[model samples]
Target: MAPNMADDVNRAVSGARPRLIVGISGASGVAYGVRTLDALNDLGVESHLVVSRAAAMTLSQETTLSLAELNDKASVVHKIGDVGASVSSGSFRTLGMVVAPCSVRTMSEIATGVTSTLLTRAADVTLKERRRLVLMVRETPLHLGHLRTLTALAEMGAVIAPPLPALYAKPASIEAMIDQSVGRMLDLFGLDWAPVRRWQGMAADAPE
Candidate 1:
């Protein structure tokens, strides 16, 4: 690398604000990832987003919003094939990463460290740095292999949080349920979101 280019890279990284890398894979619930970016924006956290091609297909099928509409929610958007992207390196620095609605395929790729795409490569970087990496795995009817893979990831220091709605929140609508789930995930990064249905105590909500 050239001297000037090195200086530019250093300046860019040194000036980086608190940020989180958001990954969306081809999973059933794209909204979890979408709202995750929105919540990060709400909490004044910069979001770097990368979406798999399969995820783009899933988003079109599940929501009326276009791809640009979803991309607009993020502070920075990187091409999935761009392995040279800033988030691909641990030197870039971030709060960590959260792959909302993480697909089984993506999870398996990250677990084995056989990263073929920028999405998984960035996840590999996060894990290597010992940074918090949360995977909102959205699959169901898990077999033994899936369970074992999840265990391996947990041992590797990745948090596996399935978006199971907290029934105790007594959610009135699906959107509320989604928010509650997303908010709780943000809690892992030490971010507080108002929509979280926090458990106060046995009589948690007995009017102040």
Candidate 2:
């Protein structure tokens, strides 16, 4: 049976646990997606995760955790090829979707609406539903085409949040930097994470 849209809507309004779809593409920063799941877990949000094949390769190279261990972090794990998953429908009624470490290929697929995987397909669904779709784009040294693609996606209501470190937070290590960026991404969904060092203001000093 198809999921009851009404029930999902009611649950959303009745303070039920919020749901967010997490997509991990074949970007360099797999740690961003991993920490996103961790933050969601800490916030009590139900996470629906879909990781790309290339991401599996990147994960193997970048981190010690196996794919199974990474899947264990999510509330629900959707296979990359499972286009028929619950998150693939707008009626699932989620807070929205976040594509952490969003790769150029995945972002382009989403912009073109020619999604080849469940990861991009779910992102497409998020956009069509007018929900907040935040893409933490991970590429650097972008050329003109990349700029244009990002512009198009921005026009389509997707937030292009590059996971740059918040130097203002005075992060002590690389992990702190990652957490800060992850926290800010969660902020888009109005989810407050403890590790986010919100700016208070310039401290009064004699710099003048």
Candidate 3:
């Protein structure tokens, strides 16, 4: 192999940990992103987090956790404007990026490749690298424009994973339901989170 190519690969793998980018948008249910970081910590996977300004506002409105508390869950935190961060480059190898609570605006930016912030830029890099880009959009009552934008993202090979409550899990609280959804989202990256309620066969529940 060429020396330059070898060096590039080496630089991308400079760290020992398998990295993944975490983007928290302005959409509600910031817990999805929070729990994602928690799961990454449990799995020993490195997390690079970038939070949009709007998301910070949502965080304040939805939960009592401070911004510092939210950032503490991540392995490494990047500013929303820091486009020069390692994650902003595709050569920085990783498992890819996931935007939990992806807002329609962020989704549209990524879909159009018109990234104006570090969060969307990192996602753009992930897509350009042919890596997995998962967006857990948290909006309901979707209009025609929203549907079209989602279709565009899907066409670009990005997964649109909306966080929906699973009644079959028999979740006892709102937290349980959120964990279930976040756990399922992690499944796309092959990360197994313990909080997820698996579906056993009907025979397993039946008495012998």
Candidate 4:
């Protein structure tokens, strides 16, 4: 069993903010990953980021920011191929792993236990260590393979979250929508967020 880093931290270290590992796959919703890192940083959570080669390609095609500028947003950044990194080990405790905009290819790899890169390895380590592993899969028009992989991962304790919007939030802009989605994702990990409005329901006294 992996030692709980939260439990083992000294008082001095324990005072530091929690760390979360954010991985970006080659999926279309790179925006989700970028926005998620920004939101986590805003919440004072330290983030370690890893971007796959395909993800880098997509990011370049989709966003104006350079990879370095993107990496600067995170507290620490690791290359996707760096399997020797601290995140690949269970000893380096993290709050959890979130693969925002996870591609179908990446999901298949995770499902099959294929750790060709550090991102996959870290995810694998997360599962083996029984830590929270959330994958925000971004594919649309899903196929049988995608469904099977999602099912397998879910069975293995991975949360397969897609980048679907909530109709109730009634977001005004793309940024707002992204924020709401990221906020909902964080909620899965028991993190409170103020990025989007929460549902308070109708006032009890005023409601019919």
Candidate 5:
């Protein structure tokens, strides 16, 4: 069942909604980022978003959402080069950061402290503050470099989650699959979601 927006917003304002910072990289699964923002908005969570240049290209390719439409989903949106953003400071309190559809290039840059832009810098701040950092890496056929970078980030306490769907959830549509993956990513930072189905064993007395 879909959550009640009004009630969820109220709960989000009260205690459930963590001050969240969402970053979108240049990956193919732009839908995951859109669904994540929608989920957060439904929960009344205040969000700060940063969209990379490459993300804009991918968004044009992957989804119908216009730049304006995408920005509307967040409470605040920052340019990728906005170094003056609040999320760049350690004093600016946030529950954590999520990089949906995190590209391999982005992952390597973050893992190596290459803060060439605001998104990378904010991720750096997230690590320095020891807050939760979830990267939904969207790559297949992982090579040695990809594995090495992911391992390094994991050692530094980043949750390296790939956008892999679960068949057990019985998703009926593409949107459902995206929701399930993004919902699980949010769960890492203690966000509550009911849109994604949890794992449950098969029924009793099954034929064997």
Candidate 6:
């Protein structure tokens, strides 16, 4: 192949790399977000991470890793307040957005279209652009209001995927369990990760 043609092909392939927006809100199980970034890196997907202020505090409280280290895991880290960032625009193509360990406050804000931060703004852009918006909502013991908000989000095409462990996968450790859930979330974007143990099937006549 000609040198110029080879160079053009390389540029095309580089430009076609898949991108996804990852949001980490102030919720427990921040490991989910951390592992999501790790998985994306493994899959060669460009991850645009936006960490909320409350999530920053949660990260400090829950993990020994510094915020700088967390940011380094992502391909691009956008400021929480940078609403004008590329991710906040619909024209910026991406696979979609995932709010790992999504806080109820963040979910509610996205559902209402009242995005107060770049994280939520990117989510709103995802929804408006008809792109997949997956929410790994962490709150449990949902009341009527929380349920209603989640329903509204679902109705508007947001995926409500809580990070539930696939006990069937029989995760040997907490990290394995977290990887299983993060793998499932990535599946929604059609990016398969190695940690996801695929369910084959039970023996037809072995058990009830």
Provide the overall lDDT of each model, using Cα atoms, as 2-decimal numbers: 0.89, 0.91, 0.88, 0.85, 0.84, 0.89
Which lDDT value does model 1 have at 2? 12
TM-score to true structure, per model = 0.90, 0.93, 0.90, 0.90, 0.90, 0.92
lDDT of 3 by residue, 1-208 (tens): 1113233334435767677899999999888899899999998888999999999999999989999999999999999999899999887888778999899999999999999999999999988877778999988899999999999888888989999998989999999998999899888876788889998757756787
Query: Considering only N, C-alpha and C atoms within 3 Å, which residue pairs clash in candidate 5?
Result: none
Candidate 5: tens digits of C-alpha lDDT, residues 35-104: 8899888877788999999999999998888898999999899999889989899777677789998998
What are the per-model numbers of colliding residue pairs? 0, 0, 0, 0, 0, 0
TM-score of 1: 0.90
Instruction: Output the worst ten-in-a-row residue range by lDDT, candidate 6.
Output: 1-10
Q: Write the per-residue lDDT of candidate 2 for residues 1-208, one digit (tens) a residue.
A: 2223444335454656889899999999999999999999999999999999999999999999999999999999999999999988887878789998899999999999999999999999988887788999998899999999999999998999999989989999999999999999998887899999999988698375
Clashing residue pairs in candidate 3 (N, C-alpha, C atoms within 3 angstroms): none
Q: Candidate 4 lDDT, tens digit per residue, 107-136?
A: 888898977999999999888877778899
Clashes of 6: 0
Candidate 1 to native Cα RMSD, angstroms: 6.3
Model 4 local distance difference test score: 0.85
Q: Where does model 4 exceed 4 Å of error?
A: 1-15, 202-208
Q: Highest lDDT, which number?
A: 2
Which candidate achieves the best TM-score against the true structure?
Answer: 2
Candidates ranked by lDDT: 2, 1, 6, 3, 4, 5
RMSD of each: 6.3, 4.3, 4.9, 3.1, 5.7, 6.7
* TM-score (C-alpha, index-matched) for candidate 2: 0.93
Q: Could you tell me which 10 consecutive residues in candidate 4 have the lowest summed lDDT?
A: 3-12
